[model samples]
Target: MIRSHSKLATALMGGLAAGLLLTACGGSAEPSSTTAASSAASTAAEVATSAAAEPITLRFIWWGNDTRNALTQQVIDLYKTTHPNITIETETADFATYWQKLSTQVAGGDAPDIIQMDEKYLAEYASQGALLDLESIGLDTSDWAEGTVDAGRFDGTLYAATFGVNAPVFLANTSVFEKAGVEIPDDTTWTWESFAEMAKQIQAAGGGEYYGVENLIGVDGASKIWLRQQGAQQFTSDGIGFTAADIQPWFEYWKQLMDEGGTAPATATIENQTTAVDQAFLGTNRVAIGFQWSNQVNAVQNASGQDILILRPPTQTGNAADGHLWYKSSMYLSAGAKTKYPEAVKEFIEFLINDPDCGAILGTERGVPTNLKVREAVAPQLDAANTKVIEFMDSIADELGTGGSVPLPGGGQSETIQRRATDAVLLGDLDPATAAEQFVTELKAEMGLS
Candidate 1:
């Protein structure tokens, strides 16, 4: 029941970022000119200076859009200015292709010095001994979200360090709700049945102008939340956590939503699921409610042009704790365990994560940072969209729970399996029970579980 850092952030926010950054960057307070402390500081600085001046070239690979790729390069260039002799070659790929390419490189024993890891596949790589033990190498997690750093651990060893934390939340369009003449549900005490009734009512209010809810069938977050509420999960340490019996009700519930006119049509719903957040049905104002990671509130809000209500998902019971809401790592940076330049790679990572200059240069493209000082330091410089995200995450601090874990290796492919089964159910090619069986069967096949 260990929780990720949330309210802990408020506790640490009192300290100013300047002094924290100074300390992280090795800047010492003024000491007596003749004191032993002064000499020690000078010796440390000289050693650091010597290391910075040594010629070291490291490669970093990540997947992102052009903006992220560009920002990352900007951070790399900034690092060069500080460490004049360090050279970092960069590689970038889109989300879909990055894992396959990284897998190929890893299998060939040609992995880059540093990698950008997603929670889904992190365990696979870390378990394969592909990522460096970040804890063993002295990367600081002092300012990060409590217990949540375990998101990057494999068998209790930290292999990666998260940039920040995000949660799965229901994004409700206030404008749509007002227009539909329906009050948003009391998410703190709402049940799944209440959620269904609310969606149906909203659709009835709209009279075909828009949908009440985005189709939840194929959306992975919805399934994860539902599974959690049932005391199950999408994945566990060994394999897929829920069986056909456990998941059939989920498919049936959403299928009921569709039959009752609470969701978009199957084709359009499937298409919406595949598109970017800003272009999804919810973002385009076609759905009154949607599910997304908390970090995506900015994108959806900007697209719909509203400060949407960020609500926790309804649970099996009316209690908020029954919702099993939890914080998830947005993403992480890991080093290759077999890296030749381990010290240089660690230094570069420390700079990107802990340095004030890096926090400013990288901005929040990687989601709001988990570091308390970095979050505070860069808060003022961010736009309203990102600022609102920070505020919303803080507001839900107490509701955040635990039990989120990465899929087991090939279990990362659960999204594809779930999508296929959902399409079958929605398109009438398979019944809910049948689709549920197929979903579990395929997932087990993917994970190579008996």
Candidate 2:
């Protein structure tokens, strides 16, 4: 939900092209004699020159801000040096307006050759036949990070190639915990009760700032994690999973926290937001804790200008071990289904994932690295903030649960369901039970399910 397109599309695409071309040509050449080799070299040089003379242009579109845009252009420049024959036409927009532009492009049948996609819209776009099967383009998941790779899969096939990894994590300001005299437990062993108790203690600490957590009843916030913990996914295996009733308890939990004064006041929670960390209770030091993805540690830390440490999501006590929240692609790269140069696009994706120099240039702007080799390559260059993220995520690697569940199905108005759930909780128009019932009803109606 937080838009973090680093404008590294050109670098990703360029590296992909060069890597693929090199892969194709370098693997099977034969040795030649000196006299014959001289003539052969001459002929090969001529062909290379001709290929270089005709530039291959790839149109790439993504979302980000000015810093990201400038970084992207620099990457493009680096990529062009290695791939002299390839020229990339860059298109970018802020996160708010990206979908509008992409939708128009899709409608006009002029979508860019390479597209950066999100999970919410992936099924819709892929089912519309707007995206190419990444597997068809020779990009396989055998080497990609499992969670990120899974996020790109739709139905049974992969429609996009992931750019990086994102896992839901909490950022705790240790200063708040110390001031409150509340001990921060190791995330792996902390349960819901322990978390609630900690919140209560933080509230008891004398300060204008309240206790432990901030409320996040909105979609892409607490609700998603709640659904996962209940062993009821947001959308079904076929994409019509749970309804409003399924999401009500998640809202109730926050209401309970608010009533206890273990979190920011209800008024502030309502005003605060999940997308904007600066608008979060924790950001204003109104609360000690906030729920968000690991990559957001920097944003929250920067907003609060305080030291922050990553914590795992609180575990459900009696629920079937659903594990921590699901990890997903920060974003994905897909080839336009209608691209005139499909092979080239495919090659571009492969490069983005595997090319060391490109991955180093792109860094972890998308989140953390999804490519094993690239992760290693870029590890040394990560800043203290990003390095902390990488280490925290990796520390919990063995404990992270599986999200091998099928991709959400298509033709079911899934996004509408998510929005409605968020609205009901934040607006307080409906209690948990009513919301759950309404959600189920709407879901069944949308899918025409029994």
Please tell me which predicted candidate would have the highest lDDT against the true structure: 1
Against the hidden reference, what TM-scores do the models get? Answer: 0.82, 0.78
Mind giving the per-residue lDDT tens digits that candidate 2 earns over 1-450? 223444476678889999999998886444421111123322333333226456577788887644456556667666666766666677877665688889899999998999988776787788788998877767755667766776777877888788888778777888787788877777776777777778877887846556567666553545667677766766655655455666677767766766676666655555565235555577756676777777667667777888888887788863324454666677888889999888778767777777777777776667787888789888998788889989977877766554434334332354456446545655566676776676667667675566
Poorest 10 consecutive residues by lDDT, candidate 1: 32-41
Task: Report how far off residue 290 is in candidate 1 (Å).
Answer: 1.1
Error of 2 at 303 (Å): 3.2
Clashes of 2: 6
232: Cα error in model 2, Å? 2.4
Error of 2 at 439 (Å): 3.0
Question: Candidate 2: where are CA atoms >4 Å away?
Answer: 1-51, 65-67, 140-142, 147-150, 179-181, 204-211, 243-245, 318-322, 403-428, 443-450
Clashes of each: 0, 6
lDDT of 1 at 28: 44
Q: How far is candidate 2 from the true structure (C-alpha RMSD, Å)?
A: 16.7
Per-residue lDDT for 275-349 in model 1, tens only? Answer: 766667888788899998877776677789865888888887798867677778888899998899888888988
Count clashing pairs, candidate 1: 0
| lDDT of each candidate versus the true structure | 0.80, 0.69
